[model samples]
Target: MTYRGRFAPTPSGDLHRGSLLTAVASYLDARQADGAWHLRIDDIDPPREVPGAADRIQQQLAAHALHWDGSVQYQSQRHDAYAAAVDMLLASGHAFYCALSRRQLADLGGRHPGPAVAVSPASHSATNTNPNPNTDCAIRLAVPDTPICFTDRLQGRQCLSLGEADGAFVIRRRDKLYAYQLACALDDADQGMTHILRGADLMDSTLRQVHVLDCLGRTRPDYGHLPVLTDSDGNKLSKSAGAAALSPDTSANLYGALRLLALDPPADLAGAPCAEQLAWAIPQWQPARLNNTLTFGVADAP
Candidate 1:
């Protein structure tokens, strides 16, 4: 338990500014803590993954000098592992198949995929409403009645009952794809990741992941959800918003990412070499100094 950490990025596009900021922060945090950091490419969904995007992502990480200690972990090669996880959950009785379609489930409970809106007194923790025999539904974890709570290194002392966050969402989709909740939880545990640093957009998802960990009899890890990278109009940084992709060839690109993470670069080395700048940044990095706001930028990452 030497402060293991990881940065798992989806290879749907080039490394936009937001992603760069996350990697730099995670890299510096691990280096500063004198811990090991691992990189895991979340390329489970092949259709959504862009061609050559994964290679480009690694190229960009190299450009940023955000080197990981061990061999990279790719989710694409882990389907058999995911299958084993799914089978294990099914056998343990902690997970079950649900035939409730989007429409039927939403009609009864506001929105099918939204945060737990109105807790059903009748259905809360009751196994009777488990998917009816006729309908085809996704597998959902049976979250306990107790609140799923954790202390975020940045946000701090958060709490939410299992039903409060998407009331029993799918771990295995109807399309047979692994839900991010189950996959990420299992991967984090398998890799011994004690510190998770990522975007604030995943804050809600963390609740479900925690429940999955509990169901698997695993302990939750420390977390730091950085603010969303947004556009000038205040939209979160994304391809839809047209954020600038990281320029691997551009000078001082990594420094800009560090600045976004709120790590103060030493003034003398403001224009110092990448290694030197990173050397200064790692020691100054602290998760508590970050903001939890849903960040957005107009054109580039801020």
Candidate 2:
């Protein structure tokens, strides 16, 4: 199969140092393999997306010369596709509606560590009067009671016991938005993405996605979850923490992000033009140079 990779961004804010690293890693890997690199803007959750953030993200990525191939894809425009997939799964008996309340799951002796959220197979409630899946009512994949395992391209062989982590999980939401596990699998398959480059924070989600793909009878793609960039205080650079947005005028932030991921860019990069620096850095991308740890703090950067 052709090597196809992608940099999927959720436009909740501008690209942060951490996000740039992810974009850089994916971009370089695709280029190195002479593969296609696609861009997908995950804007399905409009309620969470920030105003003008998507446009600003595109502008910043262009400024840094992290160009992508083909037309950009926006998830909001693909709701019908997600709906169709959900319907197919429902009809095929590979998925079913779940009605577990947050409070009940929360009290499940404690939150399950991995991705699968356990719901009793015998515990489902679908009334004729309220047939619509609730945002709280999610579609859970009916994964076989087996071990979900994969060899991480960067971290090596790994395994997650579905029964231990999270049991079957939500594929569709009560709120009508398709769940991430479901939507991502369908989108990746449709986009012909064979290599997935994302952050280690999503490791748990990977097992969940793999489980969902298995149930849907789809191919599981190769994955490389890079080290997560953390804040000065050691918290991961998440939107909730307001990671500093990328500035078109500065490659310092972007370079710092690469460093945080342990990419040893050329020494002259600090003064080189952003385009020149990126041109030099892309081919030098090395996934093995990065530590297998889940997170990286600013202090960790050289």
Candidate 3:
């Protein structure tokens, strides 16, 4: 099968070192395999999205010569697709609407919802035939109790029971917005992503996505997670954590990013043109050599 990879970024913040590292790793992994690399801007959460962050992300990628295969994809415009997915899950009994609020769930010990909490559509229709406008209901996927397992190329074997890890997760919020897990899983499959290379922080999310794909009878993608970057304080280097945005000097920082991926660029390649640097690094790409740890500090940067 032809390998297809992607770098998806939320438009909440600018591309920082950590985000760039994942993008580079994904880009090289696809290019090394002679596969197509795609770019997706995850602009689903409009309230949290920055006004200019999406365009800035594309510019940054271009500045580093990370041009994508085709035009960019935005999640916001795919609402109809997500809605159809939700409808399919509901009709197939793979998902149900729950009237229980978070506080109520907490009061009930925060475990997976039983029949009482998982309101059946038939019961809902009978009880509120007209459907109260004030009623709050969120759509949640029904996950099996069995463990979901997948081996990561870098992180090795992994398994998790969705029941224990995250109960029946919401696919659509009460406020009428599709959840991240739902959108991500459907988008990856819809885009024909054969391989996924992202930060390790989303490993748990992989399980959820796998279950989603299984529920839809869609094939799951091969997943590989790269180590997450952290600051000196050991906190994740993320926009929410106030991590500094990457400088505009792409060539200067491209060398350091390569080193962070465990690629040893020749001394002469330092500050070289981005294309030249990438050409030298692609053939030498060895994902197994990447650090298996979940997190690495910026102090490790070259």
The per-model lDDT (C-alpha) reads 0.74, 0.76, 0.86
Please count the clashing residue pairs in each candidate, in the order shown. 11, 8, 0
Candidate 2 ranges with C-alpha deviation above 4 Å: 107-137
User: CA shift at 90, candidate 1, in angstroms?
Assistant: 2.0
Cα lDDT tens digits for candidate 2, 1-302: 78899988998988877888889889888988889999999887777899998888888888877888998998888899888888888788777776565655566643332223434433442222332443345676665566789888887777887665655566776677777777787888888889999998888888888876776678889998888877778788877688777665667766776666566776778766677777776677777886466777677764
lDDT of 1 at 202: 89
Please give, for residues 1-302, the per-residue lDDT of candidate 1 as tens digits.
68999989988888887777788888888888899989999987777788998898887787666788789999888788788887888799777776555555766663233223322333533234445423444677766666878888877777887565456677888777888888899899988998998888888789789888887888788888887777666767775456678765433677677766777665566566677778777778876767555563544333
Q: Which stretches of model 1 miss by more than 4 angstroms?
A: 111-136, 267-270, 291-302
Candidate 3, residues 1-302, lDDT tens digits: the string is 99999999999889999999999999999999999999999988888898999999999999999989998999999999999999899899888777766655675567654333543333422132332324677778988878999999889999998887658888898889899999999999999999999999999999899999999999999999999998878888888777788988898778989998889898899879999999998899999887467877878976
For each candidate, give its TM-score against the true structure.
Answer: 0.86, 0.87, 0.93
Model 1 residue 249 lDDT?
49
True-structure RMSD for candidate 2:
4.1
* Model 3 residue 140 CA deviation in Å: 0.6
| Best model number under TM-score | 3
Indicate the TM-score of model 2. Answer: 0.87
